[model samples]
Target: MPKSYLITGGAGFIGLTFTKMMLKETDAQITVLDNLTYASRPLEIEALKKNGRFRFIKGDIYEKEDIEKVFYQK
Candidate 1:
């Protein structure tokens, strides 16, 4: 079975690059959790949105409910 990874700050430069690399290197699914508040680009995230294994959540760390939803529901 393929593994799953949660990437915080995944919309930033380094994070986006790493996310791309991870997708290319593995068959595992990737969940990008970003608030989309600062230092993030919607276009970049959009590019990966079409991939079945890629998911993006526009939420902040301060939001416990949002964070919990992903972790617990998964």
Candidate 2:
């Protein structure tokens, strides 16, 4: 099976930095779920998207539907 990771609040500084580290160190598919309330780093996100293994999802973790959307990928 392929490796995958779901990172919450990844648009923020610490999370985004960690995401980049993961991208460099691991071959896992990294997905980020961030509400973008605290911070909105569109440029960084866009840069990360250039990588095929990186994905960004904008949604609140408190919402059940939003959480479901992450695992219910088609």
Candidate 3:
């Protein structure tokens, strides 16, 4: 199976850039978790949803429930 990657703060510039590079360079399932903070790019994140291997989660990293969604999501 392909590797799965969980990218925190992925809507930020640096994180988003790295995420794109990973997507281009490797066949991996990428999940992005970000709270849509001021530095986040919601529109760009929305575009990432077009790729089948990509998923975006909007929630705070400080929240336990939000983090749980990563492992328990159906």
**Candidate 1 per-residue lDDT over residues 6-73, each given as its tens digit:** 99989999899999999999999999999886789889999999899998887777799879866876
Minimum summed lDDT over a 10-residue window in model 2 is located at 34-43
lDDT (CA) per prediction = 0.89, 0.91, 0.92
What TM-scores do the predictions have? 0.90, 0.90, 0.96
lDDT of 3 by residue, 29-71 (tens): 9999999999999989988899999988888889999999987
Candidate 3 deviant stretches above 4 angstroms: none
State the displacement of the C-alpha of residue 52, model 3, in Å, after optimal TM-score superposition. 0.3
lDDT of 2 by residue, 1-74 (tens): 66999999999998999999999999999999998874768789989999999989889899998899899963
Backbone clash pairs for candidate 2 read none
Q: How displaced is residue 9 in candidate 2, in Å? A: 0.4
Whichever of 2 and 3 has more lDDT, that candidate is: 3
Clash pairs, model 1 backbone: none
Clashes (backbone N, CA, C under 3 Å), per candidate, total 0, 0, 0
Rate residue 56 of model 1 by lDDT: 87
Say which prediction, candidate 1 or candidate 2, comes out ahead on lDDT.
2
